[model samples]
Target: MKTIYALLGASLLSACSVPLIQPNATQAVASHYGTSAPQGGAALDVNWWSRMGDAQLTQLLALARTNSPDLRSAAASVMAARAQSGQTGANLYPSLTGSASATISDSPTTPRSDSNTALVDSKWELDIFGKVQNAAKADTARAGAEELAYAGSYVSLAAEVADGYVGYRACRLAQAEYQNALASQQDTVTATGSLVDAGLSASADLSLARANVANAEISVTNQRADCKVAAQSLARIVGVSQSEIDAVISKGGGLPKTKPFQVASVPADMLRQRPDVLEAEKRFAAALLDMKVAEAQLFPSLTLNGSITASDPRSWSFGPALSLPILDGGASRAGVRLANANALTAAESYRAATLTAVSEVEGALTRLAAARSNLASAQSLVANYQAYFDTVDRDWKVGAASLLDREEARRQLQSARITRISQSEAVLVQWIALYKAIGGGWVAPKVVISKDLAPKKIEG
Candidate 1:
């Protein structure tokens, strides 16, 4: 009995020490971000879109969360992966099967016999080589990756819906700007006509004024069409009718001003917040486990089988079965090689994902800063141009400025207003991009990952 217990302990120790060949999971990141963006930002709210101060946007996002096909598909994938993990985990336990049969035999010049038999059969893979254990852990890691993928889908959906909403609102605001310009042009035509009647201006001036009015009318027509198209685009994103979008947006104002948010100072911290990055890490870990499982296959496997019977001569039997990979035609060796190559590939992929996440965040910060600066400049230009146009109009009324001067000033002021509105839209769009780049406030759920199962740097 002591000798048997010693052998069992030795087997268990060997099983627990399966060696893994893998790459380091950690990737180097920059200590500080570029782009002149402020450092040390606070944690972002999960419901970041609500800070945009647009109720219509909130409603649209809600609809998208419920109805987006991409999100539904991602959720289904999570469920499938979880089921597969559960199936793999079942291998760690013994399996039992029951069978029963009744037999009757009759022979000429002999006696007849009838018998009933029932038995329970059980089999268990002892996992002395750690093959089953590694495979189960690999599947569990795969399920974790799938869950992160689902969360990533949510982050992407929120950004898309918000981008669509911002686009539609910007279009409408531009349309309104053009409409106001059209009205102002009509007033110019009236004022120029009066001057022509009093012989204070040339008839050619009247022709120019009327032409300006016609051009303004054309702009308004095109802008209205563009706004309608924008609405259709938003409708497609949120899976709603164009009419419904129009109704909801009509209740609100111009482009939404998404409130400010911050990000973690450390690139690693920010990367941790991104689901896609974490998903890649999980996949890499799973690949390393797979390599371990394949390596374990190169060794021997032990399984125990037992059965009991109930009949005239009831009996029971039990024994151990061992499988060796002595002559597998290189199949097992090939599996190990393939798994190692895959682990290397997964490690590189994880590095690539980390780099991408960092680049996205950096680019977003830079673009947002530029957009905000441009918006401020555009606002100032609009204000100065408005004052200049007002003074020109007053000068023309007192006969101190010509009709041409007033018309030129009006054109400059209108152009400035258009620039301001376009910049406003740009600022909002950049904020949305930044929000997505920073993972939209997603945080990794607490999952206890085993160090032995995790990828680690291996010396060649």
Candidate 2:
């Protein structure tokens, strides 16, 4: 027994002694907006959708939050992880259970008699080597990972809803442009036909005008179809009936406008705020803990177990129990190696995730910059084209120019307007990308959950 205890103690100490690997030497990417990341801005509110200042979008987001299956699954996962953590943590303390028994016996020549017994039993494992402590830590880390995962899912879902809404709005705007273009083209076709009848234009010119009108009609058809598809997608996201979506569509509104958002300057600390990155880090930490646990198993285990029982002929008694491993080939050592390898794999995965996050942020920044530039150019072109169209319309009204000149000016104006609207939508989509790249609003809610909620036993 003494030898067993000594061996167990030695094993526990060795297992607990394994050092935690430090985070790799890779430098964190800096924020691109400034020389340094902001000390603090607005606290990342959970209702980030409302910040966009669109009541309709807010309503849609609310509906999505309630009905999104992904969010539901993530929530369920959090609950499961919490329950698992609680169960593992409970092992660190004494467990008390109530037991009751009734027995009847009959002697060969005597009447039968019954005995009833009821008692509470308590057992505690003395975690002398920190085995249970390590297990508890692993479970806690896992639970934290699950929580981050939930936040990630929520952010992702929100972003998706935003993107889908923006897409629908863009489609609507495009459809409107096509419809307006078709009307203008139809007028041009009519004017060309009148000119041809009056011997002012050739038949070929009329044919060209008719072709333009046909092309415009085709574009309108395609745009309408696209709008319908977008509406269907939005309906699926909000989990509403198609008719309900159509009703929402009946309320005319322009596509969401983009607002200037302050970008972070430094790139290095940006990853720290991303929930997915944080989750990966936590998982890596847990994996390291698991590796330590496996290493601990290489050595013998010392268990201090005691039980007290009262029998018909004996009273309650208690004593310590111990276990030792003499030999099991190289199974224990091999387990340690396996665990170490897993830890290494987890570390690599964490590094990969971090790198990927940086790349995504950088890409989003690039896209946003491009979109901004395009929008500015498009806005300028629209202004210029609008002036040109007004001038040409005035000239043609007084017979200063041919009707074809006015028609061309109108076409140019419509094209410029459509381009501007498309660019504006692009900017909005880019902003969404930026929001997602910056990890959406994951930090605040997670902090709140961790700080306010006490770890409780989760019923599976």
| Candidate 1 per-residue lDDT over residues 1-460, each given as its tens digit | 6865565555445434434465766789999787655543345856677766789989988777666677667767776788899999999999999899999999998799998889989999999768899899999999989878877887888898887777777777778888998898899889889988998888998898899889999999999998788778877777767788778887877878657776776788788889999899999999999988987877767899999885533589899986655555667667877898899889988999999999998999898889889999999999999999999999988779887898899889888988988888888888888888888887664322222221111122
Name the lDDT value of residue 261 in candidate 2. 50
Instruction: Estimate candidate 2's alpha-carbon lDDT, on a 0 to 1 scale.
Output: 0.73
Q: Please give, for residues 167-188, the per-residue lDDT of candidate 2 as tens digits.
A: 8888888788889888877887
Q: For model 1, where is the 10-residue window of minimal lDDT?
A: 451-460
Residue 159 accuracy (lDDT) in model 2: 85
What range of 10 consecutive residues in model 2 has the weakest lDDT sum? 451-460
Model 1, CA-based lDDT: 0.81
Point to the candidate with the largest lDDT.
1
Highest-TM-score candidate: 1
